[model samples]
Target: MARNRILPIFVPHWGCPHQCVFCDQRTISGCHRPVTATDVTRLLTEALPLAGQGAEVAFYGGSFTAIPAEQQQELLDAVGPFLRTKAVGSVRVSTRPDTITPETLERLWRGGVRTVELGCQSMDDAVLKASGRGHGREVVAPAVALLRQYGFSVVLQMMTGLPAQTDESALKTAWALAALQPDGVRLYPTVVVRGTVLAERYADGSYRPQTLEEATALGAEILECFLRRAIPVLRIGLQPSEELAKSVVAGPYHPALGELVKSRVYRNRAQALLETVTPGSDTVLAVAPNRVSLMTGQKRCNINWLRQRYGLHSLRIVQEPMEDWEIRLQSSESLDKINR
Candidate 1:
């Protein structure tokens, strides 16, 4: 796996016609000023020296292809010098599913863009409509196919806890997206920002954002689905920013949201393994040293849950050199009956 260190340039809502109910692009991207070719050049000038060898120059925070052709070319052209000198590995752009066309893809490929991330926020049309995303469920597949045809690595971004969205809907979206065979995926649980329609809905009781617990539980399940299909989840939650934290009015906003989600995954795996253990018996869970915190969970949530659920008199999680997801039970008593 190639490690990515992105030099991100935010073109804040540059070509988006309608703002999604949960989005506040300016707040999310922390860039309120308009971006121009000159701006792109200056951004690269500062970022290139610090970027990793295969670092990507990412144009994010809006629909890139939906922007005017001239503007798009100007931004793409600005990165040409860096690409030519190998200062940057490749260019990446995020756009809406409906914005892509064969012509645009060819243009993107010609400009040295290697990755295209589509904002396929939902697979359910009702969820899309309620979230104010203009594109429907039908557009994502064809867009992904087109990107793949052009040899561009496809990454799909999906949202959870959106207006009128349920866990089943989110799961369906995950399976549908996985079936597309995208190179990567980004999972975002909706947060009601101060100025978006979602905030108003939350204020008026029309929408109820997921609590941290709810978000982590659902996010963990979604993460497991992608992992099972061998699709890398590039991002587990929105990037934490001062702007986002300040602007968020409600929802599952946590600085450690990604870690929380991972801990939940470990918790689930532990539960499955513990189901075979004798109840009311003490047990010790040995996992990799680096994964001790994950196995224990934040505030020992996993440990506490396992004890209560399995009726274990005492549950001990320790660190030992072990393979990833490899849980070893060490016990002298009848608790040793469980096997991985």
Candidate 2:
């Protein structure tokens, strides 16, 4: 299947009632203004020609279905022509789990929405309450089932490093979400934004956000859980934006957060292979050329790690054509044995 090219229209927290502790939607979305139907029409008009066929028009950064009904209809009405003409293949909206209902799904279906992404941030009720989500964990599964029942493709979004979240809790949330068997998932590691409750908490030492290392480590663990179940992880971190960069007060925010997590995956995989071999000074790892950096890690951290752990005088990563996630260990004896 072709990867989706999304034409995003940011609503920027227009309909959200709860002020989640970590949210500064304007900063996160980089949109401080409200969106109108006219704006939607203009965006689609400009984007459709460039979107190519089967591009999705996504209403992101807000509770789309929770907005005023008239406004929702007006926005949907704006995209009606594109859908009718097949200029756009489908429509998608992101909304809270509690906001989904039979009536809303029917309305969305009539408006040509084929995908509904729920911001089911955590499966722990305590985490939900601590974050000011205003919804219980109980609402998530039924919402997923209901959306599936209504023929909409489901994407579940979960977060790591929330106020009460631990590595164990985050993993549990992933397992729970996987059991729902959604078509896709998004993993957003929490970042503290300025002018939010999180910022105040960070300043007062009430909430401690995960460091980049911590986030990447936990993210890799969560990511592996999803991959093992064959669920596609559509996104690994928040989309980096200038506004978000300026608004961040503290926490694990990295432009290349996804790459870091994948790099950790490579490190772990290589470690497993190393465990099966005897320690040697001249050890080398042969990985796919494209993933050399991921295999070696940022600043050659993985290379340094393997060398120290194995007591090697030299540990080198070389380019070799290999299958996905493949890494081969090479040494005098090991290489010869494998070649034989």
Residue 55's lDDT within candidate 2 is 81
Lowest lDDT sum, 10 consecutive residues, model 2, at: 330-339
lDDT against true structure, model 2: 0.90
**lDDT tens string, model 1, 63-158?**
999999888999999989888888888889999999999999988998889999999989999999998898899999989988888899999999
Return the clash pairs for model 2, or none. none
Instruction: Report the lDDT tens digits of candidate 2 across residue range 1-340.
Output: 2357899999988889898998888889988899999999999898888879778889999999899889999999999988888888888999999999899999999998999999999999999999999999999999999999999999999999999888898999999999999899999999999999999999999999999999999999988898888898998999998888988888889999999998998888888878866666577889998999999898999989888887777777877788756888887557657669
- Give all candidates' CA lDDT scores: 0.89, 0.90
Between which residue pairs do clashes occur in model 1? Answer: none
TM-score of each: 0.94, 0.94
Off by over 4 Å in 1: 320-322, 332-340
Candidate 1 TM-score versus the reference:
0.94
